[model samples]
Target: MEILAFIYFDPMYFVYVGPALLIAALAQWKVKSAYAHGNKYNASSGLTGAQTAQRILDAYGIGNVSIEAAKTFLGDHYDPKHKVLRLSPEVYQGRTLSSVGIAAHEVGHAIQDFKVYAPLAIRNGLVPMASIGTQFSFALIFAGIILSSWMDMPGARYIAVVGLGLFGATVVFQLINLPVEFNASSRAREILQQQGIVTAAEDKIVGKVLNAAAMTYVAATLTAILTMLYYASIVFGRRD
Candidate 1:
């Protein structure tokens, strides 16, 4: 028999999930819109994202990190494991504020790694568990629900509890990640100003782009939290 979670529920699941979904959609829209708006003009410094990131790293006395152009669109990221900063083509070579800001934000991660930022360290530490939890939590929950009432298997409750615990670790990971992202953006804005890479007006626009990017993280974390709560309510609501 296919498991329908909890057999039944009393808590209003949609009430929580609907808003989170809406926010996530809005965040995604903002990211695209903000990027498009910021991409229209070249920065006064005429430096591309890759160049700007290299300068910022040099400014911070971070000499070991390498920058590379990633062919993927909007695929910018900092790989701490390899000490490489990967910028999408648009960011790597584009002279627009959006490109610079986005690239700088990833470099901010590299900065955090160099400084041994506590929250980032914690977030990194949780990566393995969070990755496992994200991939397997739902499957385990469904399995547990399916076997809950099966007289032959008495371990259903334990399975469900383990699933919930794993998912809870994911939630913890998201919470820790928030500060890491915010701090990175803050550092990016400061560096842009201190280095005169962007004018005052341009810095404001950079903030807009970076803030929009941050909202996507917020939306994701919010959705994860609410979904976890909804599942938890159902899983624990029933007593065997």
Candidate 2:
């Protein structure tokens, strides 16, 4: 209780929290603005998201991947497990810049799969562990903290170390995610430009949309890294 109270009142806690919230808000604003601008400009190709995805796959000479419609908004994603690209209803049916850009981005992942992009491969391997780690990491950390305070035992310290290890996995996943996402967007922009799917004039808008979307991932990764660092500081600082 005393340790928890001390940590809670520590000015460093708020120091970290404040910046994280500010960054998160800015990221949200950027994402909303990007979506609005992208939606405002309809694609000249008149190609639905599914169509665009198929065209991209075909352009890359990828035959085995399937494109399908999903139920959620902004739900568009490529699933390597099923070899399917799923787009949200709006994206799947709409012929807007946002639709094509998003579809192409997902298809970009398919291209990565074909080429066996190393980062994507690493991310895929981390998914299961990261998922479990995310759910249990905090519980483990808190338990470790409480047990250490109560018993003053080394086992408690070990448990906390395990918690940190799990959380570290999540941090690594987020970091690797940045490169995979950026590479996918790069592929999307190049293919869109090369195929003349979007014109030179429209390229600016698409670029902004992709760039804005990439910022969200960057922000997420930054937030995760900061959070892990904050926890690590708390755990280690106390020991010294």
TM-score to true structure, per model: 0.93, 0.93
**lDDT of every model, 2 decimals:** 0.88, 0.84
Candidate 1 weakest lDDT stretch, 10 residues: 1-10
Cα-based RMSD of the predictions, in order?
2.5, 1.9
Whole-structure CA lDDT of model 2: 0.84
lDDT of 2 by residue, 110-227 (tens): 9999999999999999999999889988888778877776677757866777888999899899999999999999999888888878887777788888888898888888788887
Q: Candidate 1 residues 5-108, lDDT tens each?
A: 34454336667687888999999999999999999988889999999999999999999999999989999999999999999999999999999999889989
Model 1, residue 219: C-alpha shift (Å): 0.8
Clashing pairs in 2: none
Q: Candidate 1, which segments miss by more than 4 Å at Cα? A: 1-12, 150-155
Return the lDDT, model 1, position 196: 91
Error of 2 at 28 (Å): 1.4
